[model samples]
Target: MAHYLPTIGFGEWVTTVGEVVHFTGYERPLDTLKLADPRDVKLGHLLGTADMIAQMADRCYLEKCRDRLYPEFVLGGVALPLSANGDRAIKYASGLDLLRQTPEFMMETRKKRLDQTFNQAYRYIEPLFDGTNPYLDAIERSLDFLKQVLRSESWRLLRRNPQVFAAQPDSMTNVRGLMVGYFKKVWSPD
Candidate 1:
């Protein structure tokens, strides 16, 4: 059986580690004299961690992007377009609907947002890791994988029969899980 991380609240775990390790970030006092030499303290940057990124790449990131976060963005009136009368017109009922209408556009939009978010976070908390950022590469690979899945026949089938797809017992518990299984079957990673 494959393990999957929760889509939300994982960042808190990372933050907790930083707190315990006495990292420079996360509200630690800058003016106080350090008991231990700052040079000796190796800050563990979670942003580009390999295991986290791999798990994210496996499903969490994609699931969040497809089902929860994207839908929230659309529903929250952030991505809605204005009507001719200057009122907000909902173009798509949900993120799934948006994807169904324009899969390519939605995929591109999601990818662009992911890039922007990751880059912004990296800039904010400059990682001290000497080696290359594995998370970025993983994100790119995952996005590519997601794009391929979006274009797959299984995705089309799901879109065509959204109600039926949603009605399945597995999907009833977690639609994202169902979709992930479908994606795994449809698009074998290289």
Candidate 2:
């Protein structure tokens, strides 16, 4: 019976932690992630951590590039009255009002960052697996699937009209089914 950290809401958990500590202002998580006795840390924990990182990268790819951050960028910026640390609102961009990048460009930039982040995180834990790392393969497959999704008509439609959910409820069902079915096919063992 291998124990693994539950990955559900893992991205939001990380985001909350960052917000609480004012991004890059804390090191406790890094310092305390591993047990004092290295041997006491199970392989499952290492794998789970890497998997969670990959999932986080995926979430960031969507949120930062497609769904949230990009839209905020286009609309001036996030509407937070104060910074995460409760100080004045941080000007995250230079001449934010003058910036005009397309969603496609944002997605490409974010996908590159996602690749770097995921690869580095997974590389740290790869040595423990002795060359048979199914998680890495799964992550690659997921990236490929995401690429396909980005080119899909459903995704384009949603991007064009973020309010599609309210306008046509069945569209959500189609998107959900597409995601679920593609993941099942790619992840299932042959």
RMSD of every candidate to native, in Å, equals 13.9, 15.0
lDDT of 2 by residue, 1-190 (tens): 0122125535534533333332121234434443444433333234434445454345234322454443343244242235668654533332222122333333443354324322333456567788555555654554554556555634542333343434666755554455456445534776
What is the per-residue lDDT of model 1 for residues 1-190, given as tens digits with 9 covering 90 to 100?
A: 0122225536534433434344222245423324343332222222323223444544345454445545455434444656679765656555555544444553453354323322333333336555455555555676566557666735543332222234456643464454455445434654
* Local distance difference test scores for all models: 0.44, 0.41
Among all windows of ten consecutive residues in candidate 2, which has the lowest summed lDDT? Answer: 92-101
- Best candidate, lDDT-wise? 1
Q: After superposition, how far is residue 157 of candidate 2 from its true place, in Å?
A: 9.6
lDDT for position 91 in model 2: 37
TM-score for candidate 2: 0.28
Shift in Å, residue 44, candidate 1: 20
What are the models' TM-scores? 0.36, 0.28
